[model samples]
Target chain A: MLLIEMFVFLGTIAFAISGSLLAIQKRLDIFGVLLLGLTTALAGGVIRDLMIGNIPPTNLAEPQYFLVSLLASLSTIIFFERIKKFNHSIAFFDAIGLGVFTAVGANAVLSFEYSQPFLIITMGLVTGIGGGVLRDVFVQEIPQVFRKEVYGMASIAGSVALIISYDFVSPIISLYICLTVTFTIRMLALKWKW
Target chain B: MLLIEMFVFLGTIAFAISGSLLAIQKRLDIFGVLLLGLTTALAGGVIRDLMIGNIPPTNLAEPQYFLVSLLASLSTIIFFERIKKFNHSIAFFDAIGLGVFTAVGANAVLSFEYSQPFLIITMGLVTGIGGGVLRDVFVQEIPQVFRKEVYGMASIAGSVALIISYDFVSPIISLYICLTVTFTIRMLALKWKW
Candidate 1:
């Protein structure tokens, strides 16, 4: 459980870093860049929370997300050239982030007893892809989800796998299986240009 | 009713134009600009609809909103400099657009029989301010809602007026009153530098 929480938090932090770096690359002012990172990292979860009738948004309730993203942004700016050169590495971590996000989101919704499988799947996908969609929109680029790449598809696949495996395997085992499947597919897609 | 719908369309078109023009100003590709405008104009309504369990969203069901926004964006691009010169006038129109969006959003939620008045007012504010938020976020700017010109405050005021006036006036009159009140306040705010 602690490991799961750690990976989830790391996934969130990674997404935040990715978003903040995108902002910095665009030459946005510090406030603008931080806002971009904050919103990009939190928008998906915020939207999900709002849809599930959680008001005022979790980002406001827990301010650590914003603080962490700001720190990440500052660090990226300090190491700009090195960070830019590590694009593939970032994408690989992004894949892990996506897997973790989808798992957490699906598990969250299920814990709330949202019964519709379709809704669960949709939530999983939204939670996984929402941040990046927001980041792309902020960067004034067409979202990758709408273009090509199996970005959200990996998350959905992972989510479905988690749900199916939850009944048959231990929760930890199911999580590992889902993450492995998502990471493999996503990495392969990037490697072979699938 | 047709006239009311016409105003609703006008607000959507105006916001869409603003979004598209921003995208173009930022030198985004055409598809990117259009997607930004579409999402900017409709993200609030889409989120609202999805929250209320309306899948696929109203904008998807009826393409008129998207079409109007597309045309508006194209028109703005064609007349960029001319429009830019009329910044104040455009701001006035933008305020009106915000008012109309607030009214329509409140009407939609009230129609759904949501019992919480505060929630309805909050929804109205979200609907009105959501487009601009999306626009700013896409442009990688801090959302005006978080800081600046009392945007969401105006929407909240308008929603309160609308809900209160519903008891004393015809629904149409109530909408007109709300819109007028919101637009007037916004215009004054702009003029007085409030």
Candidate 2:
């Protein structure tokens, strides 16, 4: 659980950076940048929680994640030019966020005692892609995920793996399997131009 | 209660028709039209249900709304040419939906016994706009509600009206007040080019 928590924060940072950079690119104000960053980092989990009837969504109720994403967004703004000198791409952080969120979301459904395969997979997929979809929507673009089949396919594969191995493997091990599968697929798609 | 039920159906039809027409204008295929229609008609209520922790959301669990939306979409497709003559505009149906959904959604929050004003207002707003937002996103457009300030403000005002009047008035009357406020504001905004 601690390991999962650690990865969640890392994923949060990745998503915040990805979202804030895009906001800057779009010439949004500081408030817009912060709003986009938070949405990218936390909207998925908030939506997942709502579906499971978890009110006062964790991202809102728990201050730590909020603070972490806020700091990440602020850093991105402060270091915008510095980061651009290195040519930091959005895809890299997005991939990491996607993979980790996929596994974490699947695990959450299990914790809530929802074992129906469709629900578990949908939860995982939604958790992984929901934030990005929302970010794209807010930015008024067709979601790249929908356009890029491989992106969604990667998350789906990971979610499916998590569900299959959940009964046999330890929770931590299952999470790793899910993460590895999705990250590998996404990276391959990016590299091979799939 | 039956009156609420009747209006819900009417709103569902209105949203479905509006969404399907947009899809047609976008030159989407039949499936796209149907998908957008369903999304517009039901996604708001589904989101609202999920927020309340209502599993297997009423829209999904109860077959009636789904059927109505489906029929509405089918009719729009069949009567496409005839509808063009009537010069029907999306704004009209959208306004009706905003009013009814805002009222219905606010009432749902009360039924859940959660009295938090922010949450209740949000539930109402989301229920009124969620589906339209989703529809616009799928078409790769900026959400009309976000761009047109009056659209969202109308929903917000209605939600506020519902919240203020809920405690003092009967449930049905409160619903009417919410509906009237939202509908009138939306219509006036359209008429006056606000």
Candidate 3:
């Protein structure tokens, strides 16, 4: 459980940095930079929580999540030139973030006992991609997930894998399966430009 | 109250038809057309309900809303050529939708006792524009509300009106004031091309 939480936090920071980097690239103001970063880091979980009737979503209610993302975004904005040199590492961490979000989302729905197979998978996919979609839409660009190589597909696959393994394995094991599957696929997509 | 519900229904139809029209213009499939129409008609309320902990939003739980949007979308798709002739009528109804949604959104926040001044106004603005933003994002367009003249501003003004009048007037009357303010501003913006 602790291990999973650790990765999720790392994912949050990675997403925040990525969001801020994109905002800077777009030449948004300081406020815009911060807003975009927070949105990308938190929007997915917030949307998922809302759909499941989790009011005052954890992302918003927990100051720790907000603080972590804020620091991540600020650092990225301040040191963008240096961070730009670590493009490969950023992408690698982003892939991990994608994997963790997908698995965690699926688990959330399952834990809620919604009893709908589709809801589990749908929530999983949305939780993985929602932030990026909002980020792109804010910038008035087509969502890269819709147009980019294998992104949504990778998330979908990971969610599907989780659903399939969930009945057979421990919940934690299922999460690992999902995270591994998603990260592997996303990384492969990036490696060969799939 | 019945009168307000009637106008809200009218607004729902208008938003649905407008969403479908844009979908058809973009040459999307029948499924895309239907999805966009439903999205424009209901997403705002869903988002609002989620924020206030209204589980299984009325927009989704109540069949009437879905039926209205579905019928509106279907009719728009079938008689698009004829509908094109009523451009003026559609805009008029859409303006009504914008007004009612803004007022209702503010009233909802107030009724729920959210207690934050900004929450009331923010919910109102988001409800008025959320559907349109989702619709535009689905089609990869910059949200019309963000770029268009005075669309979001009108909603903001109406919400402010509601908050100001709530202390002195009946809730229904506050809604009326909000509706009138939003509608008048939207209409003026359209007329003067602001």
Query: Using DockQ as the measure, which candidate wins?
Result: 2
| lDDT of candidate 3 at residue B130, scale 0 to 100 | 82
> Can you list the residue pairs that collide in candidate 3?
none
Q: Which ten residues in a row are the worst by lDDT in model 1 chain B?
A: B52-61
Model 1, span A1-194: residue lDDT tens: 58887776677777877887888888898777777767767777876665554566676688776677667667766777898899998888788878877776666666666645555665676677788887887678766654444666677688778778888988677777777667677888799886
Estimate, for each residue in B14-116, the C-alpha lDDT of model 2 and write its tens digit.
9999889889999999999999999999999998887876777899999999999999999999998887566436577778889999999887888888776
lDDT of 1 by residue, B1-194 (tens): 58889988888887887787777777776655666677678777876676565544566446678678878887877888898888787787788888898888777787787747787787788778887887777666788778866777788889899989998999888888778777788888888888
What DockQ does candidate 3 score?
Answer: 0.16
Residue-level lDDT tens digits of model 3 in B1-194: 59999988888998999899999999999999999999999999988888777777889999898999999999999999999899888888889999999988888877776656566766787788889888887887756764565787799899889889988999999899999999999999888987
Tell me the spans in candidate 1 whose CA falls farther than 4 Å from its real position. A1-131, A135-194
Per-model C-alpha lDDT, please?
0.75, 0.85, 0.86
If both were scored by lDDT, which would come out higher, candidate 1 or candidate 2?
2
For model 3, the superposed segments whose C-alpha errors exceed 4 Å read A1-45, A48-54, A58-130, A137-194
Name the lDDT of candidate 2: 0.85
**Count of clashes in candidate 2:** 1
Cα lDDT for residue A147, candidate 1 = 49
Candidate 1 DockQ vs. native: 0.08
